[model samples]
Structure formats: structure tokens, C-alpha cells
Target: MQVNLPTNLLRSFVAIADTGSIVRATDKIFLTQSALSLQMKRLSEIVQVPLFRREQGTLVLTVSGERLLDLARRILELNDQAVESLDSVGLNGPVRIGIVQDFGDEILSGVLARFIQLNPGAELQIRVGHSREIRELFATHLIDIAVYHSVERDEFTVAPARMVWLGDPRLADRETLPLAFMTKPCLARDCAIAALEGAGRPYQLIVETSNISALRVAVEAGLALTCRSSAFTGHRLPAVELESLSLPTYFIAVMTLPSAHAAITGLAALITEAIENIVSPPFDLATDCPIKETEDA
Candidate 1:
């Protein structure tokens, strides 16, 4: 008989690996601790090997579990894709959206995938650049909706976010820190500089480019330290803690014209939902989202 692992088991396994705690994974998988434990037990019986082991009072994946985790993600991804594709509607029309690069690429990818699956006929035109440029595009009616990072809570505040220093470990050893950042109008860069200057820390700009990828490369290569929203920082460019480097809180905002279409509103809601999911500590999806009116043309 061919061995078949249930989808729910894979989901529970992935949640456990991602969260590192069965208790935390319970909230994500919506399973009681005992129920999730049963699922894991069933998975191990199917695979005929222990999937996870305890280490320092935390759940750590066994070697077999590590290998299975990759397969599990791919399977779940395909499963989700097929379901969405089959359920997609034939809604059509253009929906132009502008977003800043930092959190835009990561968060919006999943959000856009869902939106596109639901509205298969909708033509999406995405413009990625500085938040100021994106705001200009929306102001000129060149885009239907705009999402960007900002320090101001003026009208477009979608949710509260924060800028944090991220760098390779070796960067900390240097007396004069090397910094990587984009051009002007970058909130992370501004916050990073403000904190460093306020502390009177010595630093030099080693990489200055408008490309986020370049900044990431510079940081990962230990060329310089870069700052990004806590939403965007990860194991690739882990957050670096410095006693003197206190940064400012950043905000995610959406801009829409006065007479925006229904699609724009729908997309805005989807984007807000996506942000809430990715942000740490979970922002209130309903209360934090305040739709601000754009200035008249």
C-alpha cells in the first residue's frame, strides 16, 4: 500500500516548524494542543519516523522532518493555487496600484495572488518606486490606488509599523559602522541616520542605491548596515540590536482618489488584510484601517 500523508498533518507540521512551539502553532493551525499532537503523531506513523524532537524545551525538526518540511510547503502551495484557480471569477478591468519597495514586494505578492485569483479578468499594473513617487502617481490619477511607508499619520494611515536596524553579525565589530541605504525619501534610511546621529556614532555610507535588493546584498555581504520596517526584516538580514540605536515608528498607508472605483476599495481592503497578517503582534484589521480621502484635482 502506498503511504499517504494527510494535508492537515502537513499544515500542522509546517506551523510547528515556523513557530517553534506547539502552543503557538495551535493558534495558527486552529487546533487544540492535544489535537495538534495527534496530527503530528499520525504523520510520524505514516512516515515511520519521528518528525520533530525537543531541544532546550523547544520543538526542533528532526533531519527527516527538515527534508519533509520543504516538500510540505510545495505541496500546500500547489494545493492552494489549484483551489484558487478553480474558484476564480471572470471579473475584468484595469487596476493600477503603486507601492513602495520595502514591504511591497513581500506582502503584496500573496495579496495580489489572492486578488488576481478572485478577479481573473482584472488587468493589474503595478508600479514600484519611492513612496513619494508612488504618491505622485496616485495624485496625478496615473494609478488607481497607492500603498507606501510613511512616518506621517496624516490621512492614509493603514497601520502602525517600525523601522529597525538589520545587519550581518560581523558589521558590529567595526568601530565606524558602514551603512547601506537608498536615496532620499526613504523612511528607514532617515530613521537609521537620525538614531545614529543622535547617538553621535561614527558611520559611512558604503552603498547608496535606489534598489532594495542592492541594499539587501550590501547588508548580507557585511558591507553595511541597513534599516527596514520590522515587517520586512528576517533571518536573511536579521535585526541587530544596539543600545544607542533607537529608531522611529513607521506607518503603512494607502492613498485613494476621491471618486475611486469599487475595485480600488476592494484592493485596499485586501492589502490592509495582508499587512495585518504579516505584521508582528497582529494589528487590528478593522480598527487600524482608516480610508483617507485624496485632495481634489
Candidate 2:
């Protein structure tokens, strides 16, 4: 007999994985903890493998669970997309949005295409810049909606960011650091400098530019190290998680203007969902990633 995966079970599993807790996941999926647990049990029974292992009171996905997460997300996304497309009333008026560059490519690929699909020929203006630049644009009303990473949750935060230092592993252990960052007024740059200086690590600002691509190129060439969220860096570069590189959790946020119209608000909601899907489950997705000293160690 061929076993089938149920959408309901996958949805609950994703909710638990994304939120890091079945208790919190309950609020998202509107199911009680017991019901969600039962669904997880059923899912594991079908898969015939244990799906979750708890860590520090938070649920971490097992290898089998991680394997299921990507497929589950795709399944639910297709299911939701099919449903939404059937009733998606295209919005009117141009919507201007600003997204920070770190998340630009990953986010825009899906969001822009989906928006266009839902609202064909809808006038959509988008700007990509550093987080600080995006915030400034939002403040000046240059953009109706903004998606950026920030240290503080002054706006609508969608997901937590796992900031890591990306560079050649050989260079990361040097005494004096070589740093290249997006010019002043950048969140990642600011955090990197602060963390290094706070740790009393000698450093040189080897290069400075307004382009994230330029900085990443510099980092990839092993010219200098820069701070970036783990969301985008894993495959291309070595991520260093040293004590000095250790930084606080940041958040990807969506901010909207108070004067925005309903269409802009609706677009903001769309952006919010997109961000959540990307990063809600991105954290701790890797094991060789940063881990703190065990209390018992």
C-alpha cells in the first residue's frame, strides 16, 4: 500500500517547526497543543521515523523532520496558491515597497512573481537598499511599504534573524580583523563594528561601499569579513560563529505608512506572509551552526 502525506499534518508540522514550539504553533494554526501533537504523531507514523527532538525547551527538527519541512512548505504553498488564485481580486494603484538587499533576491523572486500573478499589470515599484536606507525611504514616504532587518522591533516584526560573520575561515581567526561593510548607516555594518570593538578586537576597515554585492565579493575574496544574516550565506561562504562574532538576534520587519490605502495595506500583508515563510523556519536549520557552551560543560 502506498502511504500518503496529508496536508493537515504537514501544515501543523510546519507550524511547529516555524514557531519552535507546538504551544506557539497552536496560536498560528488555531489548534490545541494536544491536537497538534496528535497530528505530529500521525505524520511520524506515516513517515515511519521520529520527526522532532526537543532542545532547550524549544522544538528542533530531526533530520527526517527537516527533510519533510521543505516538501511540506511547498505542498502547502501550492495548496494556498491554488486557493488564493481562484479568488484573488487584483488590487488597483501602484504600490511602492523597499526591501533590504540581504533579503532582496530570495524574497523578491517569490514575492514579486506572486504579486504580479495575483494582480497582473499592477503598478508595483520596488527599491532595494540597506536596512537603514530602506527605513529612511519609509520615513520620507518614498515607499509605502518597507521590509528590512532591524535590531529593535519598532515595527511589525515578521521573523527573527540569525546574524553570522561570513568570510574565509582562515581569515576569521586572525588577531586583527579586516572588515568590509556597506557604508555608514547600515545595520549589519554597524553591528559588526560594534561587536568587534566591544570585544576589544583590533580591526581595520579595509573597504566600505553602499553595495552588499561588493562587500560580499570582498568577503568571498578573503579580503575582509562582514556580518550578515545566515538566511543567505550558507552555501556560498563559510559562516563564522565565534564569541566575538556572536551578536544578538535581529528581526525582519515590515513597516507601512499610516496614510497608506487599503491596497498598500493588502500588499504589506502579502509581504509579511512572504517574510514569515522564508525566515520563520530558517533559523537553526543547520547543525554545524553556532551553538552556545552547554551549561553542564
Scored by TM-score, the top model is 1
Tens digits of per-residue lDDT, candidate 1, 163-265, equal: 6788886786788988889989887778888888999999999899988777777777778888887665543556788778888766788877665555557
Where does the lowest 10-residue lDDT sum fall in candidate 2? Answer: 280-289
Clashes of each: 0, 0
**Global CA lDDT computed for model 1:** 0.76
Per-residue lDDT of candidate 2, residues 1-297 (tens digit)? 998888778877998999899998754455678989999998999999999999999899999999999999999878656544543456544567888888777767777778777777456667887787788888867678888887875548767777778888777678888888787677777777788878988888888988777876888888988887765553477577666457777878888988665556777888777765555235432341333545775
Q: Return the clash pairs for model 1, or none.
A: none
Cα-based TM-score, every candidate: 0.62, 0.60
Model 1 RMSD vs true structure: 16.6
lDDT of 2 at 81: 64
